[model samples]
Target chain A: MWAFTLRRLLYAVPVLLGVSMLVFALIHLAPGDVVDILVPPEVPKEIADSLRQRFHLDEQLYVQYVAWLGRLMVGDFGVSFFTGRPVAEELFGALGNTLVLALPAAVLGFLLGIALGALAAYNHGTWLDKLFSATAIIGVSLPHYWVGIVLVAIFAVVLNLLPAQGMGFEGLPTSWEHVQHLVLPVVTLSLIPMGVISRLVRANVLEILSQEFVGTLHAKGLFSRRVLYHTLKNAAPSALALMGLQFGYLLGGSILVETVFNWPGSGGLMNLAIFRRDVPVLSATIVVLAAIFVVINILVDVLQALLDPRMRR
Target chain B: MSQVLANLPRATEPVVSVEDLHVRFLLREATVAAINGVSFDLEAGQVLGILGESGSGKSVTLRSLMRLLPPARTRTEGRIRIAGHEITAMDETALRHVRGAKVAMIFQEPMVALDPVFTIGVQIAETIVRHEGISYSAANQRALELLEMVQIPSAARRLKSYPHEMSGGMRQRAMIALALSCRPTVLLADEPTTALDVTVQIQIILLLRQLQQELGMAVIFVTHDVGVAIEVADRIAVMYAGRFVEVGPTEKVIDTPAHPYTAALLTSTVLGSTFGRRLEAIPGTPPDLRALPAGCSFAPRCRHAQDRCRVHMPPEAVLAPGRITRCVRVADGELDLGSPNLSERSIAKP
Candidate 1:
């Protein structure tokens, strides 16, 4: 198992390097000049030229990439052009904020998905199954940003029940105040993934229910609850994989929900960097998200291997 | 009537009695009558082999005894009594106690019959704990004993081995051990050896017979192979189109098959007396359950099927004290089951 994990980590290096290179290239290719955006029109040409040279923007693309790669290898993410703060420091801060919002949403989504999916499978063709399935379809279909706006309109503007936007009051995170601000954004971000996971789990559970082992368990005279437990245990590996993938997706792609809620997460930070042409912070954030996604996929593979004996080899 | 009931033999009471079992599968496209008026009584320690081709409702009849069919999709009307307990009338909770305690079943595909994730010991021990109300340790001990009973080698270590780790025969032995774990009075084996190799099939059959005698459990073994049925069963019930066409003692049924279908089945056996000649294959497939003819289900394929046979289903005729056959030709004395020695060579040696 340790060997498998080590091999997976080794395999991830090239993927991360490839992702870093892609992000760098894509950011560079975009129709924007970071130096021009940073320097005002009134600034002298020499000062702007000096700023470009200082940031290595005047160098060849490959040279800039190599320089960035060297700094990244040494844990030195260059300073953000807009903020003048170290990119790693700013990225980590944004990442921490993102995790605060994403973690609860991911956990809640996974638990609810499994519960709802199991209920749907147990009920099978009943009215409850239909209801859950219909709700899942709606959840999957509706865009998160649209859902967030609608929720804000209902809960914030109309009812004034909950805070509609941002992480906390005055950006000072407090438990109660943070929760008050979290509800809408978390719900919006979680909905789509919850729907997807529920569907995946439902399908897997239904298939497991029809397995010959389930019939054998029934013939053993186990209570329906125990039979369900066995069924869920057998179905768990695939569902867990889906959950990990969904978590990785939620972490990397909750951009729209964060934007709609103005939650101070990496997604919003990335949005701000893109707008302000903060290339270093943007590239660094992308690399971190990609690394996280790769790590999560590896974790899921290991988890599946552990759960299913057939996959141990 | 009460006096007649009182006069009935006490020692001969059936452990498993199924009466007029009618199983209908209600699909959206069609309603299939899988088991049509099937009835039988299984005595203690007696092995009754149900022989039939695929789709003959052999498995369905066995499952019905356990009430294992899907409630919504299947419509079953019958009296299924296991050791005098009316299983059909019992609700889920009551049925749970009856299953694996009073009655247990082992299936055809041993590879899939046991959960892949759980070890053989855990699976068997779980049944024991549920039915026996024993601790996990006691159940595990009993599981080890059962594996020993099934003649599995390295019984103690095998308890920890997963189902996939065992060979096909070993897995089947484990499955049988699981079935016998609760010491059920009635064991329903649904084509248990069909998925096994020929050599393994014989070993399992012998093992089952040995276990049946030792445990004194009524065994209802379902199989498609007539040779196997003759080897394992004391009495054989030959089924066709969801109904038993012939049922009698193994020797009597094989020697003097009263139904044309039974005669055809015996003749089709490769080990039969006419081995050197071209085998007599049953001409057509079993009829579709949904669109079965109003008459005898086997009339289309029967060589002696008369015009009357086409219009009316045959009522079962009592050929002897313990033998019954479902065929109009039996009444006319027109059917002749070839030779007794046809299956004698293939029957398992005592």
Candidate 2:
């Protein structure tokens, strides 16, 4: 098992690097740079030259890429063009906040999705099944940003129950306060994925329930609950695969969610950097998110293969 | 009934007696009556072989005994008595207790009969725990004993192995062991060896026969193979179109098949065929259950099907000692079986 996990982890490195390199190229190839965006229109040519030289903007594209790659190897993502701080420092702080929001939402989505999906599958073709399935379809079809905006509009504008947007203030205790601030954003972000995962789980559970093993389990005279739980447990590898993929997707997709909520997460940071054309911060954030996604997918695949031996070969 | 029970053999009465059993499956806009008025008595420790083609209702009848038929869609109408207790009317919980503890089923496909995620040991252990209320360790120990009983090598080591790690034969053996772990009085092997390769198929059948003898459990061996039916089963019930066409002692049924369908089945088997002509196949598939003929379900496929056979379903006829056949013409001697002259004219007419 350790060997399997270590092998999977090792395989993730090139996947991360490949994705990083692609994003890096695309970011660099896009027109405009941090220097172009940050410099004043009135600034003289010599001053612009010094600033360009300072940030290595004067170097060739390949040279700059190699220098950035070298710095990345030593655990440095270089300084943010706007913040003038190590990109890693900003990234870590933002990552913590993003996780704070994403983790709960993910947990909530998974819990609700699995339960709902299981219920729907168990009572398949009934009214309850139809209700849950329809709700999931609508949830999945609606866009995250649109859902976030609608949630904000109804709760903050019409009901006036909570703050419209943004994280908690500096003085207020965060746990409950932040959670209150998080509800709308988290719900909006989780809806589509929750719908998707639950539907997938329902399909998988329904399929597994019909398997001959399930019949054998029934014939063994095990309790209905025992049979159901056993079947679901066996069916879990498929569900787990979806959950893993969704986890990776959530890590990256949460950016749009965070932007809508005005949450101070990596997504929001990336959004700001994009607007200011902070290439280093944007590239670093993309690289990190891509790497995290790759790692998560690899972990999920390995875990699935481990849990269900059929995939080993 | 009480006197009969008292006079009967020492095992807990005949484990199950299914009388006039009918099962109908509602699919989409149509209802297919799979089992129609099927009756049988399974004595404890006796291997009862149900032989038929694919849609002959053997599996359905077996499933109905436990009320394991898929939810509200499939309806089971019958008096299924397990230890003189009516199983058809029992609630889900009661039926559940009866299923694994008193009556267990071994399905057709061995590889698919055990859940893939759990280790073979854990799978068997679960049955022990569920039915016996034993501790995990005790259950595991019993599971190992069962594994050994089924001749699974390296029983202890294989406990941790997943379903896919084992070969097809091993998986089937594991399934059998799991079923046996519960110590069920009635073991329903629904075409247990059907999914196995030909060589492994014989091994499984022999193993089942051995286990049945050792355990003294009533085994309902459901199979389409007449050869297998003769080898393992003491009594054989030949079903056609969800009805029991003929049922009697294995030797009697094989030698003097009273029903036309049974005769056709026996003739089709190459086991004792003297002539080495190319093998014959059952002319057509079983009739569509949804659109069945008005009278006998087997009329379409019967060589001796007459006008009366098409108007009325065949009544049970006791042609010989211990032999029961459901055929209209056989009772009246309208159909001759002594030397069925199947010339070109009689063959193509049906």
Candidate 3:
């Protein structure tokens, strides 16, 4: 198991490097650098040239890539061109805020998905199956940001039952007021994972049900609940992998939902970086998100290998 | 009924009995008459091999004995009793209690029959725990003993292995171990060795025979292999289109098969002493169960099929004394399938 974990971690190095390279290439490929947006037309050529050289804009693309890569390895994410604030400090705060939202939403969405999927699969071809399946489809298909706006209108504007946006001044939702601030965005962000994971679980459970082993289980005279235990164990590996992927989607932070809720997460930060052309923050955020996705996938792979012995090789 | 139970020979009463058993699969598209009027009684310590091709209802018959058929889609008509439990009348809860406790089964494909994610020991141990209400550790010990009984090498280590880690033969051995864990009186084996190689097939057959005799459990063995049936069964039932066309002592039926279907099956198989002869195949496919003709089910495939064979279904007739065969010609005693030997009848129609 330790070897498996070590091997999965080893496999991530190239992926992280590739994502970093892509982030660097994308910023370079854009129409202008941070200096173009930061410097005014009235600024003298020497002043603009000094600003450009400061940000490594004076070097070749590969040379700049190597420089950025070196700093990235040393946990140096430069600084935002707009505010002159260290990107790592600014990004970590937003990263923590996103984690607070994403983790809860992932728990809510994935647990609901597993329960609903198991219910639908067990009651396959029945009205309950149809009802849950339709619910999941609607959850996925609904314009969730629009749903977020409706929630805010109902809760903040009309009912005045709860706060509609933001995590009550950011770090963690410590009080009830702060927790209420989490509700709308978390609910909104969770819809896609809930829908996707449910469908995947339903299909996977149905497939396991159809295998000849189910009959063997029956012939062994296991109770219905015990039979379900065996079914769930077999269905777990694939479902866990899907959950990791869906959780990856969640952690990426839906920009629209975050905007609608006025949440100070990575999504809103990235939104600011894009409009202002804060190249360092934008590239750093993208690399961090991609690395997180890779790490989540590695964790899922190791977990799946533990669950299913055949997958160890 | 109470007086009848009292009068019957307690030692001779059959461990498993099926009366006028019928099974139909009620699919949305069609109603399939999978088993049509099947009946049999298997006494304690005896082995009855049900031989047939695929879709001939041999498997259905075995599954129905334990009410293992899908309830939502199946319509069964009959009575089944196994080890003093009325299977047909039992509810889900009752059936579950009796399934592995009194009646167990070994499915055809061992690879699929054993749960792939679970260890072999847990699968076997769970059944023992479920039926006997024993401690988990005790059940595990019993599981180890069963594995050893079935001749799994390094029984202790093999118990921790999942189904996929084992070879096909080892998986089947684990399957047999699971079926025997609760010391069931009647074991229904649905082509348990069909997925195994010829070499492994013989080993499994020998092991099953040895266990059956040692445990003194009544067994209903279903198979397509003639040699397997001959080697293991005391009585052989030749099934065609959901009905047993011929059933008799294994030696009697194998030596002188009255039905042409049985005769064809024997001739087609590559058994001992029949190597040099050009073997024959049963002509045509089995009759469709959904829309069977009002005649002998084997008429299309029978070489001796006459005009009358296609006109009406033949009723069961006594072949000698203990044996029974169904054929229009055999009904009239006009077909001399084979000369009879001594007739010391031990079993008669119920």
Candidate 4:
């Protein structure tokens, strides 16, 4: 098992490299530069040239890529073009904020999805099943930004309950205060994944319920709840795989949601970098996000193997 | 063990009794009458083999004993009594206790019958704990004992093995151990050896017979193979199109089949003089349940069907003690009763 995990990790190395190369090339290919954004349109050509030289924007694309790759190997993300701060420091701060938002959202979404899915399966063909199925479809269709706006309008603007945007008050790190700020953004970010995960879980549970072993379990005099538990255990590998994918999607797809809620996560930071053409921060964030996605996929594989003995090989 | 046996009701009472069982599957466009007016009784330590071809309602009859059919989609009218308890009228909670305790079932495919993710030991132990309310460790120990009881090699190690890791025969053995764990008075085996190899089938038949005798439980073994039915069943009930056409002691049923269907089945086997001759396959497919004829369902396939046979259903007739056959021709004395060729019969007997 350890060997399998190690092998997967090894396989991820080239994948990460490929992702980085693609992101770098795509960003470079866009019709603008950091120097153009930094220097005023009224500035003389020499000042623009000096800024380009300082940031090594004058270097050939391959040279720039190789230099960035070398620095990345040694745990350096260079400096941010706009802030002049170490890109690593800026990236980590943004990542931590994203984690604070994404982790709770993921955990809550997964739990909610499983609960609703189990209920949907247990009450199959009933009004409850129809209700949940409708809710899942609606949740999947409603865009996150729209959900965020609607929630802000209802809770923040009309009801005067719970703040709608940002991480928290600048000086208040109290957990409850943080939670107050987190409600809307997390809800908006988690809706699509929650819908997707619940639908996947419902389908899997329904399939497992019809399996021959479920009949055996029933014949064994197991209560319906226990039978459902066994069904869930058998369905876990598939559910876990979906949850992993949903988590990866939540991390990368939170950009628009973060922009709406004014959440200071990496997604928001990436949004700003894209508009400003901050190449260093943009490339660094994409690489880090891709790396996290690869790591999650590996973790999911290991978990699936552990859950299903048939996959251990 | 003595105390457990003492707690049981008198051994003279039949372990299983079914009366006029009728199962109908309600589909969108049609209602399928799967089982029609089947009745039987089984005493302790006896095996009654139900023989039929596919769609003959062999499985439907067995599953109804446990009320395992989907409630909304299936309608069953019958009285099923297992170990003196009226299962047909019992509520779900009461039925739960009856299952795996007074009546247990083992299915045809062992790999699918056992959950793939769980260790065999956990599944067995779970059944024990659910019924007996024992501690986990105690249940685990019982699981090991059950595996050993089924004669599995390396039983201790197999306790931790998943269903997929074991061979088909081993998985079936494990399933048997699970079925017998609660010492149920009645075991419903639905073609338990059908998915196994021929050699493994014989082994399972022997094991089941040995287990039934040792545990003194009544077994209703369902199968499509006449040969397998002969090997394991003391009494045989030959079903056709959802109803039993002939039922009697194994020897009587095979030697002088009263029903034309049973006689036709005997001649179709690849044993005796028929071994080298072209097989006498049954002439037509089973009648569709939705549009069944008002008279006998098998009249279209029976060789001796007369106008009257097609116009009216045959009443079940008593032919001597402990024997019943449903054929109008059997009562008319026009049916051929020649002894089934002994050479073929002997060769067919396992």
Candidate 5:
């Protein structure tokens, strides 16, 4: 197993390299220049040229790529256009902020979704099943941004229950304050995934409940609750597979929710950089997100292998 | 022979008795009468075989005895007394107590009937623990004993193996072991060997017969194969269109079949069909129960049917001791029933 894990880790290297190249090329191809945005329009043409050369923007695209790739090999990700801070440094802060929203939301959504799914599936054809299934359908259909706005309007504006924007109480520690601020955005982002996860789990459980083995268990005089839980355990592998794929989707969807909520995450950084035409920051952020996505895929593969040994062969 | 008759398990009462048992399946669009006024008795240690075509309600009848039919579509409308208890009227809680302890079922497809996620031992032990209030360790020990009794090779090692890891025959054995774990008074085997190979089918049949004798448990063996019926059943009930056409001692039913449907089934056994001889076949399929004939269900397919046969249902005629057959012609002595047993008399190719 360790050997297989080591092989999987080795395989991730090429995947990361491929993602880096694609992100690098796509960012370069997009019609915008950090130099054009950095220097003012009123500045003299000669000084602008001098500024461009100074920032190494005057080099050919290939030469620039080579230089950038060289820096990337040495753990340098250039600098942000507006802030003039190293891209890697900004990414670290942005990633930390992003997790503050997405991670808790993912965890919270999974727990609630699984419980609801089990209940709905066990009580299938009853009012509880219909109620929870309808809620999930409505939740999945609503956009995260729209949900965030509505939540803010109701809780922050009209009700005065929670603050609308920014992370946490001002006087408290960073982590605690950030955690408090995370609630609304996390909920907004998690609603869609929660609905999806629950529906998937419910469908899987319901399918398994009809299997002959379940009938055997019932005939064996197992209590209804015990039979339900037993079916859930048998149905878990399918649910876990669904959850693994959904986690990757949740990571991507979090960007939109984070931007809408103004939660100071990687997504917020990307949105700001897009407006200012900060190529280095945008390219670095995309690469980082892509890297995270690749890692998640690898994790999912490993989990499937571990859970079902037949897959290893 | 007198000593053998004396050694038979006869307690002056049947372990299970069904009287005028009717099972109806209320489908989405219409109601299907699967079992129509079927009645039978299973004495302790006696193996009763129910032989029929697919959808003849033989399985439905057995399921009704256990009250194991799907709740939404199925409804039982007659008395089912198992070990002198009216099981048909019992509440769900009361039924659960009687289900695994007093009566148990082994399904057709053993592969699908055993839970895949759990080890075979866990599943077998669960039946004992669930109904008997036994500890896990005690249940496990009993489970091993049950497995060994079924002739599962390496019972201890096999206990840890999941259903998917076992072969078809082994899985069937494990399923039988599970049914026997609770030491029930009756075992309802629903086409237990239908999904197995010919040799494995014979092996399971022999095993079941041996176990039933050793344990003195009445087994209601449901199957479509007449060969299997002849092998295991002391008495046979032949069914068609949710009603019994004939029932008697296995030898009597196979030899002197009184009903035309039973005659058709016996003659159409497809003994040499593989050699491309269209061995005399039954004329038509069993009628749809939703729109059954006003009189006899088999009248449409019966070549011996008269106007009266189509106009009125035939009642069961007591042919002789331990023999009964449902046929209008038989009451009139229009058909003779002195034929010899086919399986017992026919010679097989070497």
Candidate 6:
């Protein structure tokens, strides 16, 4: 089992390397950069030359890529072009901020999804099933940013219940005062995942319920609840596989949601870097997000193997 | 040990009895009459083999004994009394105690029948814990003993292995061990050996017979193989469509089948000495269960179907003593098929 985990981790290395290369290349391949904003309509050529030389934009694309990759290996993300702030510091703070919202939202969404899915699947054709199914469909289908705007309009604007946007604190949310700033963003971020996870869980539970062993369990005189336990255990591995991917999506896909709330997360950071043409901050955020995604994939594989003995090989 | 003491006063009463059981599967467009009207009584320590091809309602009959049919669309009617518990009358909660405690079933394919995620020991022990209310450790010990009883090698180690890790035959052994764990009064085996290798098939049959005798438990063994039925059964019930056409002592039924359907079934198998005795082959397929004829279900396939035979279902005609056949032609004694003690007369002529 340890060997399986190790092998999966090893497999992830190449994928992450590929993602790093792409993040670097794709960001650099864009049309404009800090150079465009830095230079005026008719600046002195030597001043522009000094700016280009300082950031090494004057170097060949391969040299720039190799240099960036080399520095990245040693944990240096370079300084931000607009603010002259260290990219790593800015990136980590944004990641921590994202974690505060995404983590709780994920927890809420996942737990609710699993509960609703199991209930709906066991009940199958009743009104409860239809109600939950409709909820899940609406969740997955709706635009989350639009949902966020409506949430802000109702709670912050109309009811005067909660603060509208931004992290109340400078960093991670710890106290309740800072946490209230979380309501709209977390709810907006969670809707799509709740819908996605619940649907996956429902389908898996329904499929497992029909397997032949469920009849065997029934024949064994197991209580209906006991039979349900067996059904859920079998259903878990597949549901968990999707949950892992959804977790990655929750963190990475919360960009627009974060933008609407004005929350300081990687999504917000990337948004700022994109407009200002801050290549260092942009490259660092994308690579870090891509790396997090790869790690999630590995964790899902290992967790699935643990749950299902058949996957040990 | 506990079974023998309980068997004294109830030895005369059949361990399992079903009367006029009917099963119908209600689909969107049609209602499938899976089991029309089947009746049987199996006493303690006896094995009644139900022989039939697919869709003959044999498996459906076995499942009906436990009320295992889906409650949504499938309807099961009539009395099923196993170990003195009225199966059809019991509610879901009451049925649980009677299910693994009084009546248990082994399925056709062990790999499919056994829970794949759980270890064999866990599956077996859970049953003991559920019905017997024993401690988990005690249940585990009993589970180990059961695996050994089923002749599983390295029993202790094998207990921890998942179903997929074991061979087909071993998994079936695990299945049997699990079935017998709660010491049910009767066991319903639905083609238990059908998915095993041919060589393993005999071994499982022998093991079942030996266990049944040792435990003195009644068993309703459902199978498609003629040899398997004859090998394990004292009495044989040959089913056609949804009802039993003939049921008698194994020797009597095989040597001189009173019903034409039974005769066709016997001749179709490539058994020793019974080979090339294909006097008549069954024609066409089983009737679409959704649209069964009003009269005898086998009339279309039977060569001796008279106009009357096509008009009314045959009554269960008792020839002598325990021999019963569902065929109108049997009443006339012109069956050319067989009469009671026909095997003796045919032997004497030779």
Docking class of 2: medium
lDDT of 2 by residue, B207-302 (tens): 998888778788888998988898888889999888988888887777667788887776676763434334456687888988888898888877
Q: Candidate 1, residues A1-313: lDDT per residue as tens digits?
A: 7887788889999999999989999999998687878888899999999999889889999999999999988989899999899998888877888787788889888888888888998899999999998878888999889999999999999999999787765333578866888888888878877899889889989888888888888888999888988888788898888888888877774778888888777877888888999998999999988989999989988887776777666
- Residue A199 lDDT in candidate 3: 95
Q: Which candidate is the best by DockQ?
A: 4
lDDT of each: 0.86, 0.81, 0.87, 0.87, 0.81, 0.86
- The fnat of each candidate, in order, is 0.67, 0.95, 0.75, 0.84, 0.56, 0.75
Prediction 6 TM-score vs. true: 0.94
Q: How accurate is candidate 5 locally (lDDT)?
A: 0.81
For B1-350, candidate 1 gives per-residue lDDT tens digits of 11222244555678888899999999999999999998888877778899999999999999999988888899999898898799989989999988888899999999988998888999999999999899999999999999999999999999998888899999999999999998899999999999999999999999998888778788899999988898888789999888998899887888878888888887787755443455668899889999999999999998888898988889888888768888977866876655635545345333
TM-score of chain A of each: 0.94, 0.92, 0.97, 0.94, 0.87, 0.95
Better structure of 2 and 6 per TM-score:
6
Q: DockQ values for all predictions?
A: 0.68, 0.80, 0.77, 0.84, 0.51, 0.78
Off by over 4 Å in 2: A170-175, A253-256, B1-13, B334-336, B339-350
Across B130-197, the per-residue lDDT of candidate 5 in tens digits comes to 88888999999999999999999999999988888899999999999999988889999999999999
TM-score of each prediction? 0.93, 0.93, 0.94, 0.94, 0.89, 0.94
The 10-residue segment of model 4 chain B with minimum total lDDT is B1-10
Candidate 2 chain B: minimum summed lDDT over ten consecutive residues — where? B339-348
Better of 2 and 4 by DockQ: 4
Ranking 1 against 6 by TM-score, winner = 6
Model 4, A254-282: lDDT tens per residue?
A: 78888888877788788888887888999
| CAPRI-style class, candidate 3 | medium
iRMS (Å) per candidate: 0.9, 1.3, 0.8, 0.6, 2.1, 0.7
